[model samples]
Target: MIELRNVSKRFADLVVLDGVDFSVRKGETVALLGPSGVGKSVLLKHINGLIHPDKGEVWVDGQNLTRLKRKELARLRSRIGYVFQYGALFDSMTVEDNIKLGITDEASAADETYSRKRALQCLELVNLDPVVAEKYPAELSGGMKKRVGIARAIAGQPTYLLWDEPTSGLDPVNADIIDSLVEKLDDELGVTSVVVTHDVRGAFRVADRIAMLMDGRIRAMGSPAELRASTDAAVQEFLERDLTIPVHH
Candidate 1:
């Protein structure tokens, strides 16, 4: 389980997360939904210990992230896979090599044969053709690059997956593909996942539960149906503006 209790953070005079409380159950997917710049990404970072909170605790698998040592944190991080907002693929590396870099274990990463197999396996998991392995990032389309990013993230076979705007820069059709991929992954891998996205449609389709962040706090959170029926003014306004009349799966 991943839990954040009254977590708070700030940069100089700007407050990002203020007394935020969040949690993700094991083997479940949760979507952190909010408008851009509402600290959605910041909250995601807290899960992986990329950013430490100023107050409170971040617990993952019963271990406190903020209290862990550097090496301990590194060890814990290997169990978590983080997919960045942008497809942060290395331009100079082949798709196979890029995915190989995600092999967090030193011994496995050094074994050339295993790395190659794992890379191909991850590509297949992301619905990519094996032929794409030899190609560089420049050769693939935006959606393919995003898939490659996810492939790299899952190369290590992490216990938890944290996605930051996985479908951010795609057309509706491609975005739908990624959303479906998310669903497929959940059923196939059963890894705990936290998807940070502003897209309500995609979130509703992929997440088992949705948490809306507003004013540096979780304003509302529940299943898609529960959020849709929310009476909160802010929640209603956001859905009204960001979504069409009826939200369908």
Candidate 2:
């Protein structure tokens, strides 16, 4: 459902992505793995047209993101939900209102009754209580805020979900919680998902396939078991570093 062909992006002298080619199939969850300062997040933005690449093309659900008109891009984005790195909740709005903003369907967003019900349902789907919807972001714990962010992302009933560092900044316990939630949601919602994260354990636990980005290119990619059995130096180095296994080479 998503494809990136020869995509390249650079900021002045710093090249983030170089001839990157990536794809995620329908109903499959793919994790983009890379170290800090790589272009994992930048690549995610390209799928939804949030950031345009300097070269190459990005296709999502059959539409070329680079060629889409502004209105058309917006329409396409409505079917895809994005969960930002740090929740990015509006502090001024209640949790329910924050999630309500995710409702892109004009009629549903306009219907106060439907929005309220949808927000509550989304919160439940994220394992949050309905009472939390009445609270503000400031009132939530870090993990709770992340769950709320997820609730907001799914509030629109999107066909695709893009998560940018969903487990970042959380404690190990919270990170595991988020990982399990990602797995559960993928099974329940059956939405095509692309998760951008540096956490190898979480990626292994949640993704159907993992793609490692290094030196502005996809260095290695495969299922968790396949990656573990890989002999590539760069791939082995990364796996050993994150998994704490000894690297012979």
lDDT of 1 by residue, 112-208 (tens): 9999999999999999999999999999999999999999989888999999999998999999899988889877988999999999888888888
Q: How well is each residue in 78-172 modelled by candidate 2, as lDDT tens digits?
A: 99999999999999999999999999999999999999999999999988999999999999998999999999999888999999999999999
How far is 82's C-alpha from truth in model 2 (Å)?
Answer: 0.6
Compared with the true structure, the alpha-carbon lDDT of candidate 1 equals 0.93
Clashing pairs in 2: none
* Residue runs of model 2 more than 4 Å from their true location after superposition: 245-249
In order, the Cα lDDT scores of the candidates are 0.93, 0.93
Output the TM-score of candidate 2: 0.96
